[model samples]
Target: QGMVGGMKIPLVQRYEAGFRAGVAATNPNATVLVNYTGSFTDFALGKQVGQDLLLKNTDVLFAAAGVDGLGAIQAVKEAREAGKAVSVIGVDSDPSHLAPEAVLSAVVKHVDLVVYEAIREQRQGRFQGGNVSLGLKEGGMGLAPVRLDFPGKDEALRTVEALKARIISGELKVPTQPAPSGTAGANP
Candidate 1:
C-alpha cells in the first residue's frame, strides 16, 4: 500500500479509511490492502496494483483512488476474464454499473446532503462551528445495494441491512476512522 499524498486531505484518506473500518467491523478476518497512486489521474499504477493483488489471491479489491480506481476496475475485469475469482468494491459514486460482472458493491458518501444541511443551518442562523458527526444513522455514509451480477448478493444485502440496523440501534458497534480536518468531500 502506498501512502503517496498527505492523509489530511478529505478525499485522500477519509473515504478509504472509513471503508476499511466498516469492513473490519463486519469482517474481522478480512484483509484490506490500500495503495495510493499519488494523484487521482494515475490510472496505470492503479491497474498494476490491482493486477498484482489479484495474482496474490485477493478476491475483492476496493478501488478508492478516484480516476485511478477506474484502472483497478479494469484489472478486475481482466482477472475475471482470465477465470480468476475476483470482484471489485467501488467508492464515491456507484461503479457497480461500470463493470457489472466484477463489481460487488460500492461505498456511497452523501456529500450533497451534508452541504445542503450546512447551508440551511447557516441560512437559519443556527450554524455551529464545532464538528458535526454524520454516520449511517444520519444518512451520511453507507454501502450501496449489491450489484445484481454478484452471486448471492441478495442474501448478502439482507445480512448487511440487518447489521446496519444493529449498528444504528447501538446493538453493534461500527468502527469509524477519524474525520479528516477540512471540508469533507464525497468518496470516489
Candidate 2:
C-alpha cells in the first residue's frame, strides 16, 4: 500500500535506525542483538529467541514483533522471577498494564483518534484520504508513562524530552533509514 500523499514510509528500517541511534547515544559500546520469529503469533519462537538474547547479555528488548512480543514478555517475566532484571518496550499498543516491572514504555499509535478524525472529516464532507503523520506534536502518538522504579529515570526522561524538542523543531532529523557507509553523501 502506498501513501496517498506520496510519503515514503520506511517502517522497519526507521525503527531499527532509531533503536541504533538511541543505543549509540546512551552506550557507544553496547552490543545490539536483533532477531525475527518469522511469525508474530509464534509464542514459542519468540520466547525461544528472547531466552537466546538473554544468554548473550541483552538487557533491553525493543519488541515490535507483533503478537510474538508477548512471547518476549513471557521471557522477561521468567527472568525477573529468577532475580534478573530486563526491560521491554512495546509497540502498537500501550502494554504497561501487562508487566509493570519489566515494561519501560510502549510506542502507542492512536488508532481511535485517527478513526475519529477520519469519520469527522467524512461527516463534514472534508474527507480526503491521504497520509497523516502524527507524533508528539500532533498528540496522535506517544510513549506510555515511564515507570520510575528504575534508576536514572528522571535523567532518561529529560534526555527524551530534549530529543523530542529537537525533532519537533527540525533541529534533529531521524533518518527513515540509515545512510549506507562510504556513500558520497553519508555522514563521515
Candidate 3:
C-alpha cells in the first residue's frame, strides 16, 4: 500500500505485518528490518543486500523476491559458511533444497488451487475478475516443510499453527495495509 525503497508493492507490507505479528507473539522488543530487491531476477543484488542486512544484525531474512530470492539463499549460505548465525524464509514454491542449511521455511503459494477454483466458478456461472486473497486458512496456500536443522523448529511450528488457528477463527485479523502512526493495541 506504500512505497518501500521504490518497490511499491503489497506483498512486502503484508509480510512485514506477519513478521511484526510473530515478534509480538514471542518477543515484544524484537527489531524487524526489511530490505527490498527491486529486480526479481537480480540474484547478485539480492545477495549483496542480504549480506549487508545480515551484517547489520538481522536475525532472519525473508526473501519474497522472484528468482532474485535464490540470491538471498546464497547470501545466507555464505554467511553461515563464514560462521554467522542467520536464516531465511523463502516465498512461492519450496526452495529449501537449494540451501538446506540456510533455509528455515517457505510460504508455498498454491496457484493450482486458485486456478481450479476459478475454473469451477466459471463452470458454475460465478467467475469474477477481481483479485482473490488467500492466506494460511485458505486451501490456496500454506507453509512448506520446515528444515530439520533449525534449532527452534518445534516452537516455530507450534507458533505457526496457533497463528493459523487464530487467523481462521477470526481472532487475529492480519493487516493488509500499512497502519497509521501510533496504533498500539493491534499486532501490526
Candidate 4:
C-alpha cells in the first residue's frame, strides 16, 4: 500500500494511522509506504509521488492530499489502464465517479453535515466552541460504497461492516496515531 498526504498535519496523520491499522488487520504481511508532499495544492508532485509508489509495486494507493490527490488518482487510473493490478482510495468524498475503474473507495468526511449542525446549534443558542470527535457511529466519517467489481467484494463489504460495528461498540480501537517503530502498523 502507498499513502500520499498533503502535509504532516494531525488530520492526515490520523488518516495514516487508521490506514495502517486497517492494512495490519486485513493483511499482516502487507507493508505501507508513505509520502508527504508538504503542499496541498501541488498536483505535479502528487503525481510524481504516486508514480514512484506504483513503480514499487504498490497494489493500492491512498490519496489524502486535497486537490493534489486528483493527480495521484490520475496516475492510478493510468496504471490500471496499462493493465496493472492497482487501484486508488480517495479521500474527502466519493471520487469513484472520477475514476470508477481505478478508485476502490473513499474515506468520506461529512463536513457539510457538521457545518450545518454547528450553525443550527448556534442559531438555537446551543453553540459550543471545541473540537468534537465523530466517527462511524456519529455519521461523521465512513467509507464510500465500493464501486470496483471484484471477486470478493461482497465478502469484503460484510467484513468491513462487522469491523465497523466492533469499532462503534468499542470492541475494536482504530489508532489515532501510528504505533512506535518495530511495532505493528508502525511508521517506517
Best model per lDDT? 4
Task: Report the C-alpha lDDT of model 4 over 1-188, residue by residue, as the tens digit.
Answer: 98888888999989889888888877777888888898789888899999998998898999999877888999999999999999999998999888989999999999987998899999999999999977888889899888788888898889788889988988888898965432339322
Deviation of model 2 at 32, angstroms: 1.8
List ranges where model 3 is wrong by over 4 Å: 1-6, 178-188
Preferred candidate (TM-score higher): 1 or 4: 4
Model 2 weakest lDDT span, ten residues long: 1-10
Top model number, TM-score: 4
lDDT per residue for candidate 2 within 10-94, as digits (tens), equals: 5644655566566655565565666656665676777777777777677887776666677787777788778887877777787
lDDT of 3 by residue, 1-188 (tens): 11112143777667656655665566655555666767777888878877777887876777777767778778888888888878788877888888888887787889999999999999999998998987777777788887646677788789888888887888888766544332211453
Q: Give all TM-scores, in the order shown.
A: 0.75, 0.83, 0.85, 0.93
The whole-model lDDT of each prediction reads 0.69, 0.66, 0.71, 0.87
Task: Write one digit per residue (lDDT tens) for candidate 1, span 1-188.
Answer: 11122223566566656555555555655555555666677778778877877776777787877777888898998888889878887876788777888887777888988999999999999989888878889988788777555677677677778878987887766433532322121221
Off by over 4 Å in 4: 180-188
RMSD of each: 6.4, 6.3, 3.7, 2.4
Q: Which pairs of residues have clashing backbones in candidate 2?
A: none
List the candidate 2 regions with Cα displacement exceeding 4 Å. Answer: 1-10, 178-188
Q: Whose TM-score is higher: candidate 3's or candidate 4's?
A: 4
TM-score of 3: 0.85
